[model samples]
Target: MPAAAHDLRTPLTVVLGQAELLERRLARDPSAPVDPAGTSASRARRDGCETS
Candidate 1:
């Protein structure tokens, strides 16, 4: 099921990329506030794949 594996990998890649970006941003400015909605969306994308 390569297609199914690809579908799952896509979202996980996105989540990881977003997390990396967030990490870099926080590193630059540790005082910056994280957006709750953005965090929720990332978690949703991650969880969505797990439930599939």
Candidate 2:
């Protein structure tokens, strides 16, 4: 099911990219309150809500 795989790929990529960016930002500014896991986008993802 290439179509199903592709559908999953985009969102997974988005989540992974966001995580990497957050990781870099935290590395540079450890005191920042921008927690990736606490973000609205991440919350919706964890709750199985549509991000779009």
- Backbone Cα, N, C clashes tallied per candidate: 0, 0
Give TM per candidate.
0.55, 0.56
The 10-residue segment of model 1 with minimum total lDDT is 43-52
* Candidate 2, 1-52: lDDT as tens digits: 9888779878876886686577666668867776546854456567765534
Off by over 4 Å in 1: 32-52
Tell how far residue 30 is off in model 1, in angstroms.
4.0
- Model 1: per-residue lDDT, tens digit, 1-52? 9999888888867776777677667758968887765654466666664433
**Which segments of candidate 2 are over 4 A away from where they belong?**
32-52
- Candidate 2 backbone clash number: 0
CA shift of 6, model 2, Å: 0.2
